[model samples]
Target: MKCIVGLGNPGKRYKDTRHNVGFMAIDELIRRNHWELDKSKFNGNYTVEHIGNEKVILLQPQTFMNLSGESIKPLMNYYNIDVEDVLVIYDDLDLPAGKIRLRQKGGHGGHNGIRSTIDHLGTKEFKRIRIGVGRPVKPIPVVDYVLGNFSEEEQADIAISIKNSADACEMWLKKPFLEVMNEYNS
Candidate 1:
């Protein structure tokens, strides 16, 4: 089984924020596949289902955004899953809204949640599906902007991106990464 983790903070206050895009994608996947996210003792919620022959664990870390690894590591250790099978879904301030990038490995690129996952996992060699949230035109407080709600103009694009992200997750679960990138990222 593979663990596909959507990193974000919990609660309604963060429900529609840019930082919670990961959560949004998970919501889409569950809605599309009729998967149930039941609470577990691992400081997160998980759902089990099959994507072809592969059993997937859909996860939403409850350790909040910053300390996401705290929830991820325990479940991974318990399942004894390889670091390579972990797929991380997160927001990317580097790309435009509605854009999605699927990469095999790289740096955290200043995302604290991703950084924590890398630290806990001891490698950056896992799959990452980064959905663009875009950057502010003028400089703004990082935390404020990331945790902030989307503007009216950004709403449509964000909605499109969330669905596209779910598609990307499904592609990753089925096809090889390079083929998924060729089909989706291009």
Candidate 2:
């Protein structure tokens, strides 16, 4: 089994914020598969579905960003999924807006969501897909910038990135993750 987790703060208030790009990508995947996150448990909303013979779980932790692991770890344990079979999607401030990067393992890079995940999972070896929202060009605080909505100029790029992220996820169910990374990382 494989688990795909999207990190974000839940509720309508954060729906369109830059920090919620991970949720956006997951929404795109749910749309494509005609799936709904109908089950709620372990502080997350999730769905179990088969994708080309692979049993996959799509999860959106309702525990908010900084406490994302509070939701992920329990669900993973309940499903008997290993660290290697988990893929976490979240926003990244280091890369330019709309850019996406995939990695087999890495540090949290100061992301509290990832930090919590690492702490709860007791490992830093899970896969990740980072959707870049870019750093604030203005003098605003980092938190404010991440919580803010994207500018009009970034809308197109954001849309493309979300689409690409969803596509890559579907591809992962069929092909090797390395191949999907090579194909999308370009």
TM-score, prediction 1: 0.96
For model 1, residues 88-127, the per-residue Cα lDDT tens digits are: 9999999898888889899999999999998998898989
The best candidate by lDDT is 2
> Clash totals for all models, in order?
0, 0
Which regions of candidate 2 deviate over 4 angstroms?
none
- Cα error, candidate 1, residue 94 (Å): 0.6
Which regions of candidate 1 fall more than 4 Å away from where they truly are?
A: none
**Residue 92, candidate 2: C-alpha displacement in angstroms:** 0.4
> What's the distance in Å from true for residue 118, model 2?
0.4
**Candidate 2 lDDT by residue in tens digits, 50-142:** 999899999999999999999999999999999999999999999888899999999999999999999999999999999999999989999
